[model samples]
Target: MTIHPPDRRDFARSVPVRLWDESFAADPLRHYQALRNQGPVGWGELAPGVPAYVVTDRRAALDVLHDEETFSHDPRAWEATVPDDSPVLGMMRWRPNALFADGAAHVRYRTTLIDVFDLVEPHDLRGRVHRAVRLLVGRIGPRGEADLVGDFAEPLMALVFNDLFGLPESQGDRLHSGVGKMMEGGDRATVGEAEYAQYVLDLIAAKTERRGDDLPSRLLDHPAGLTREEVTWQVFLTLGAGYGPTANLLSNTLSRILGNPLYYSTLTDGARPVMDAVVEVLHHETPLANYGIYYVRRPVAFHGVWLREAVPVVVSYGALGILAEREATERRHPNDASHLSWGAGAHACPVKQHTLLLVTEAIERLTQWLPDLDPVVPRDRLTWRPGPFHRSLTALPVRFSPRSPASEPSGVRS
Candidate 1:
């Protein structure tokens, strides 16, 4: 028998105005309690009759994101609702990359690139992300107020991705742009799937010509290696998956610190001070809020619901259903950390360590370069950018003093 909760819209209607509204763009975790009050499986939809559990329970979320046999991460669960040629389709399809593959195939693609994600070691990138953060900080340092989103977050992503993947200097910017475009919306309109496809095809050809020890070239040489099209597909995956989430993560942390004074002292007072804060922010407000699906694939019961296949199950980033334990108050400590920002199970972010290392590096550098780092644009006046898959802040204005020596590029932004 299928179990479901009461109507969330109706229940949420009784919630305080500010609390309800905040549930939309910003942290919806506060509503998690209320949603859970109704039952595990709640009635509501990003679409109609889309019965889903407004999961606020830590254990439940792990059970769902971690279990693939009952639930699918293919992103194809919504084939019935979304259009066939949607950019999200780029995500659902077993395109030019490996994430779309499952079981053994998924294992192969992940194993091939495991080294890239593994070797990143945040300490390794400290100097690199530090240099980028320092340079961007300098740009807005004189201003005394600037958006952390652009000045700090975006640039950090470029530097981290570039350094980790070891992309060539000349092509790095374009790759970044292409990925950003895809993240903002559909790959069809943004990546111009066919056009970007050709472009990536050409890019692989050129990179293959040199065949150096760089990331792409190295992947090409790996056994059970992929073709150029396959290579480009994976490139698409990196950009689509990694880019905006990191940007959003940085911006969200700043927003939290700015709004909640408790965060500043509480989060930063640790051996690895910045690490706890970053994880907390990511835990509280996942950049990728929910993983979309059209069907359950099998008769699987989650959070008390026996969801049938083809039912659009929105598996959120575990923010709603998951819990952040009190012990996580300590840095590098997850004993109390029940947060599920990264999806779980076989589909859990294979690049988990790499992404955190990048985030940790950015935070550490921010602390070092701008100990007094604070946003310039008045907090309430700031506007945030919106994306369906990733929650993003369009701009974050801030200012800092005690600048560093890193130089900024011409026409640079803070």
Candidate 2:
């Protein structure tokens, strides 16, 4: 898959596409198409003055994701170049966790995470999700009209993840608000990042004094012998990583399911599984749309473009979704899980099963309780949150038949 290098004149005349603009947030596909028009690798600005080479072509993206030696995950070089107050710094700055590590360090951090999460059985995780969903549904079920993003998906994730990480359920709002603002990368990003950091620091401090049967305590006691600071960063990465994308997945899946009447009917009647709708969203409108960030140590020619040293080379997962749809054939089923939404190679997402279980169970429980739920606005008309990295909705308004908490099933009420 070789692409001819653009001539110097074309490169000189090209302008970097701005990804943080409201226009891109509203209709990212249009911006993605424009980026693709530039070449396999195109120039993009994540924020003002932060330029990166966005990989829009599928093959080129795969090459970057797979070749870890050529492209590093550590962002210290790039971090040094960016401003301390850059909104993107909250996400792009180097951390001791696996997301920003490489080689032995990456393996060690990743092993600890996998081991701790593996301790949680599927049934136990499902029960946690069910309980959280029931509580959220109980709150909103009586209201009849609810914004699924705020009232359901976002809070549900906070409740479940907070419980898993040993934080009191009361802190769920802090978790949601902090992570949401931090991922959005804007005026409030610094405040959001500080709130989230304090939340994690408090959790680690509490767990250190009195350990519990939770992810944080387990990481603290692991044989790998991680330090307090190391454990804090791991918990920070896991909680933040789990919350934002999973919430978006839940909301995005719900939006797709409710937007199509036939699909909703099929889903309720058991003709089509909820996983199909989830996969469709993963293929076409994945959450965490454009966050696969990498950097090279030196200038290198990759798939025709000369990548500058230390500049970010982001895999445009949203753009890859577009190419996947265009090249999709009958042989590839709609439920195919070949999408790069979970990413690829060494840095691929490790908690996919837990995420899938939580989302699917949450949807099942909500739909079962409020079977007559309807969307207040069309999917296309729904507004998205503005940020370069995430494809999230600002709100997902839905309406349903109002029901009393006392009328719900025995275990549903809070």
Candidate 3:
């Protein structure tokens, strides 16, 4: 299992592949394969002229994820090198939150999040998700056709999250618009980042004046004694992290279920749980595909590659899924949960159970309300949003039998 470093001269000479473009968005596997061809660790550009080493091999990725000593989560060293207007900066920029910290600071911030999130019981979360799904279906059910990504997945996350964060339901659109633009990582990214910052600021300010049973208020009350500024960043990280990936996961899972007639039948007939489809998407096509970003403090040799100081070493979860599939001699069951989609080691997703509950429940509720829902276009023909960090769809249009809101079941009508 030992992987020795490749020849430094040849590795240094290899050209970095571009990841933040239409080609990568349209056919990510093709670009992943191109990176794999270079070696376990391949050079790639996250955006125009932004070069970094993208780790495509599972062993190399695991090595990077587990070895915090060699690879640091802090990107300040590299951040200073990038332009102020870099599209990727929104994602990679250092914050006081757990995602960008290392050592004791990481532990302090991470503990506060875990402690607060642990208070959310499964039943409570499921109820919130069901309520959001009901509201969404009521709006779209009467139309007979809707973009699931826009009309359902995105809004569902916003509604549930807004409720959990103690914001008015009307403010969900702000959370959705800001996070969506920022995750897309382009000219609008800066605007998205600013909008999201203001949204978090407002939430903190409101909670400061009067606390509530929401995440921000909980963080403020935690024993960590985090200052107002610290609380704001934590809320920013959690909301942005929770919303974008969960929305994408729900949309991606729906696309898989609706795209296959047999699968849809199994789901509607109760032969399979919606969770099976969700797990299948996690294994084959994860939402936050290549966002496990790490940086080295000094030039170091790792798993057959030379990692330059402060350069990003991205773990391609999408590529890792493909590689795992190819390397497997036996067929993997649909419910297998071995994928690295939630990431690994220290920075692994803290709210994975919450995320799973939200997505599965949302899907189950939607399918139950509209059993004959069908994709307007084939899944293969659908377009993806352009970005290096996320695997998100631009839209998922679908058609179903129309029903008036008044005719729907009593509790769900908007």
Q: How close is every model to the real structure, measured as TM-score?
A: 0.75, 0.95, 0.96
lDDT of each: 0.56, 0.87, 0.86
Per residue, candidate 3 scores C-alpha lDDT tens digits across 319-400 of 8886777666667664554568888899998888899889888887788788889899998999999999888989999999
Question: Over 4 Å off in model 1, which ranges?
Answer: 1-23, 26-38, 43-56, 75-81, 85-87, 90-93, 119-123, 168-177, 184-202, 258-272, 292-295, 299-303, 321-335, 377-383, 402-414
**118: Cα error in model 3, Å:** 1.0
Local accuracy of candidate 1 as per-residue lDDT tens digits, 1-414:
223334212322232212212244554444444455545544333422223434445555556656666655454555565655555443344453566666677787777777545545555666667666765666766666666776668766776666555564455456556655555443334354444445466656767787754566767777766777677677667654676687777777777675655666554453445555666666666677655332456665555555555544555553452445422345645523455666567766777776776776676556545556565566566554433345667677655664435543332223
Arrange candidates by lDDT, highest first: which order? 2, 3, 1
TM-score of model number 1? 0.75
lDDT of 1 at 367: 57
Q: What is the lDDT of residue 367 in candidate 3?
A: 81
Candidate 1 vs candidate 2: the TM-score winner is: 2
Runs in model 2 lying further than 4 Å from the true structure: 1-13, 409-414
**Model 2: lDDT to the true structure:** 0.87
